[model samples]
Target: MRPMPRPAEYGQWDELPDVPEVPTSRMGDLAVLDVRERLIRLIDRRRSEDARIAELEQQWRERGGVGESPYEVSRQWVRRQTTEGALMLAGILDRLLRS
Candidate 1:
């Protein structure tokens, strides 16, 4: 096996030491707490909405809503709901950042 060459042999004597990378936090303490609260509230609201939707569905099924949907949900309704949900989340983040 050949011997390894020294770093000084290549005219390199002053090599800088390795530096540790500092992790960056996106949100400060206040903002982080606010975000956590908002997220918890959103989660609670979603849970309530889920329960209400389940109850309504059970009632609908009990009423013999079979074969086809009478008042079928439209694409616009779905899009609106999706957009509202996304916007609500975005609004929360925006508020958190603004504060």
Candidate 2:
């Protein structure tokens, strides 16, 4: 049998690179409005990333990829959980900003 494919090769979720920190000088200078605007933009960008990942997974499935394997199932579950957690955090931040 062929060796099992690596997660990256199969388009499985991989750890995203860390977002660069806001420079200390910039952070101190940002107004509350500026911070809120940046948060909104980040949330929007994250939604786009989630959509693109989902689309790629759908395409892989359409191609008859092995999605039913236990490993794959767990990987998908983890990805879903991570996405949900990020969304929850975004909602909290949005509410805080609105208050």
Candidate 3:
């Protein structure tokens, strides 16, 4: 394999490093904690949604939700759930960032 070029070789370095500093306020700390809690809640919500999705999928299959293939049905269910999860996460992130 060919060797990759270094970032500096492309003149990418600038005057300042692109690191973000931690906020030094009580609200900043509370915001961090809120984000953590929201993240945990998001995880739990995903798990529950996944389980419900699986149960519904099994029911659908049993009720003759057949299509071209079982994979097609499973993919549709996964896609729906993923879209919902993405939207939910985007909203949460927006709120957290604004705070």
Candidate 4:
């Protein structure tokens, strides 16, 4: 591929136009978005961790663990984890909303 072309006058950061100032209300709005994104990421992390825990339980069962089948135990464990995560997320969201 050919080399990309650069603008002849694109050298000075000081020459760049001044960025517009954001209003305080808009900053608050962005904070709400940030909170929602964080919540989503936290939820995804919890789900992945719960899945990992279930997988670990399965491996343990395959290694002659004495208990109910891996499927049953993992299901119950994942359920508890999900419930706890949900409660935690609710509290976090509540606190964020109150801010």
Candidate 4 has an lDDT of 0.51
lDDT of 1 by residue, 11-89 (tens): 2211212212222464355654555555556455545554665576667778988764332232223333434454565
Model 4 TM-score relative to the real fold: 0.45
For model 2, the stretches where C-alpha displacement exceeds 4 angstroms are: 1-30, 68-99
List the global CA lDDT of all models.
0.45, 0.51, 0.49, 0.51
Best by TM-score: 4
| TM-score quality measure for candidate 1 | 0.42
Q: Decide which is better by lDDT, 1 or 4.
A: 4
* lDDT per residue as tens, model 3, 15-99: 1121123345534576655654554565565457657767777887888887643443443444444444545555655555566
Residue 58's lDDT within candidate 2 is 75
Cand. 2 Cα-lDDT: 0.51
| lDDT, candidate 4, at 90 | 56
Off by over 4 Å in 3: 1-28, 68-99
Tens digit per residue, CA lDDT, model 2, 5-74: 5555544434432333344445554353454455455545655666766677777777787745334544
List clash counts for every candidate, in order.
0, 0, 0, 0
C-alpha TM-scores of all predictions: 0.42, 0.41, 0.41, 0.45
